[model samples]
Target: MSERLPPNTKIRGTGFNISDFWSWGFSDVLTNSLRGVFAEFLVGSTLDVLQQPRIEWDAYDLMYKDKKIEVKSAAYIQSWHEGQYSKISFGIEAKRAYNYATRSYTPEPVRNADLYVFCLLYEKDANLIDVLNTEQWHFYIVKTNVLNTLFPQQKRISLSTLEKITQPVSFTEIKETIDQAIYQ
Candidate 1:
């Protein structure tokens, strides 16, 4: 039961050349490929847009209203390398979320124009399938950088409360997911 993306699946690349790590100093073809997959589908066809490393914006991806979006693409892997035993990840060297409730994480300088975000492009279907079933697929959304300032921590936060803090196009609630991503 294995299948590949359609020849005309139309996955567009943003031509973004992100480094694997400041330490690695090498561009990762795999990560960029996945990013291309996500960018093509982030808007779900309502608007046709593609994101890449060279979008000519001050950020990563562009939005429906022509807003410049800074994208942080990540792929987490639990494994050990050459001589180290660790569960590492192939990711954009940027943290893509904000928690106004905590203000704990460090991110790029896009607070006002560069909305904090996380774009996860995965090929595995079991983890997240049926919602948007395309290998050339990815999810995009803005995070709540002001949650701590705007929320009551002791209480469970809900999506409706953070509804305003999301991508203008996809409108995906992103902060909580980024939190979960850090731990899970």
Candidate 2:
């Protein structure tokens, strides 16, 4: 298990601290990679799983209660500015699971998570975008069974295609919606 470090924890033989590294690396939360991790963190927070350390190579992003969750994120505004906002899509590909202990992979591809949470940063204006603001985002929750039945072979899905299936919920409703998806 990874130990949580204090912000003031110093690097040996260096003046920098953990906070310094975090500030330099994760200050831009809108970037694709960081944003995805941030979305996972947001969902984990909503599910009351923030106490758990994130496992980078885990087949699913989080395990809340008995439900395994996979989170995907997309945004209109990116860290780098272009003439137009980028198109939004989320990956839903099934892949073989990697075992850390055995140093082996599953024989076949599969959807390891029980459900998926799709997070969209809908704020179009770069200047008005605040990733920290929950109101600026929309989340769509769907059971793996339903998703697999709808688009069995689909590797990725567009926002429009996704909208036809599941309605989005606010940040505040995420946990409720997830419970509904899982329990109902």
lDDT of each: 0.37, 0.91
Q: Per-residue alpha-carbon lDDT of model 2 for 11-49, expressed as tens digits?
A: 888999989999998999989999999999999998998
Indicate which candidate wins on lDDT.
Answer: 2
lDDT of 1 at 167: 34
The lDDT of model 2 is 0.91
List the lowest-lDDT window of 10 residues for candidate 1.
77-86
Off by over 4 Å in 2: none
Stretches of model 1 off by over 4 angstroms after superposition: 1-29, 32-46, 50-57, 77-117, 122-140, 143-184
Q: Tens-digit lDDT track for model 1 on 1-184?
A: 1343332443247332232232254223344454443443454233344332333222344454434344454433111113332222222233344544565543643233333344443333333422234343344444334433454232333233334544322224333444343344
